[model samples]
Target: MSENEHMLAVRSRINDLAAKAKTPEGLTEAEKAERADLRQEFLANFREGMRSQIEMLQVIDKDGKEVTPEKVKQIQRDKGLRDD
Candidate 1:
């Protein structure tokens, strides 16, 4: 599935779990398991998306210099996303 579709599915499951949490009955064991799995998948997707976006970033200074943070620069360098 596409990223948008995957994200929608994850969000839907999360919302479902949230609603279950508000009820006096609460989530069943199966629902709790599903929630944990969905949460992990969602976090993995979020981290990957953030990493991709950050990889393409180039921070500029007021003086028109490349002032990207050292941490990000190190990631880029390690990933071979940038030579500098």
Candidate 2:
């Protein structure tokens, strides 16, 4: 599946597990483990998406100076989003 589709599936499963945990029967140990793993995967994906956004960022001052951080600029350069 595409990234968006996969993320939606993961989110659906996580919500399902959460609902199961709230019920009287509650979740089995395996379900709990699966929920934990899914949460981690979700978090990892979120962080990577945020990182990509940051890497593509460019900060410009009102005076027209490029004020982006050196590290971020380097990342953007490496990704071919910047000339230097």
Candidate 3:
């Protein structure tokens, strides 16, 4: 499946596991392990998306000075998304 489909599946599984955990029966060790792995996968995807947005960012003040943060600027520069 595609990335979106995969993410949706992961999210659905995470929710299901969470609901199970709240019940009196709770989760088995394997289910708990699966939930942890799925959570990590979800977070990794989220961080990459945030990083992509940050890399594409451009900030300009009223004086027309580019005010993007140095760390983000360096990321953009390294990715060849910006010059200087």
Please give the clash total of every predicted structure, in order.
0, 0, 0
Model 1 TM-score relative to the real fold: 0.81
Give per-model CA RMSD. 1.9, 1.2, 1.3
TM per candidate: 0.81, 0.90, 0.88
What residue runs in model 3 are displaced by over 4 Å at the alpha carbon?
none
User: How many Å off is the CA of 11 in candidate 2?
Assistant: 0.3
Which model, 1 or 3, shows the larger TM-score? 3
* Predicted candidate 2 versus true structure: per-residue lDDT over 1-84, tens digit per residue: 999999999999999999989999999999999999999999999999999888888899999998999999888788888887
lDDT of 1 at 70: 91
Ranking by lDDT: 3, 2, 1
What is the C-alpha lDDT profile of model 3 across 1-84, one tens digit per residue?
A: 999999999999999999999999999999999999999999999999998887899999999998998998998888888767
What does candidate 1's lDDT look like per residue over 8-48, in tens digits?
A: 98999899899988999999999999999999999999999
* Candidate 2 Cα misplacement greater than 4 A, ranges: none
Worst 10 residues of 3 by lDDT: 75-84
Q: Which of the numbered candidates is closest to the native, going by highest lDDT?
A: 3
Q: Poorest 10 consecutive residues of model 2 by lDDT?
A: 75-84
Using TM-score, rank the candidates from best to worst: 2, 3, 1
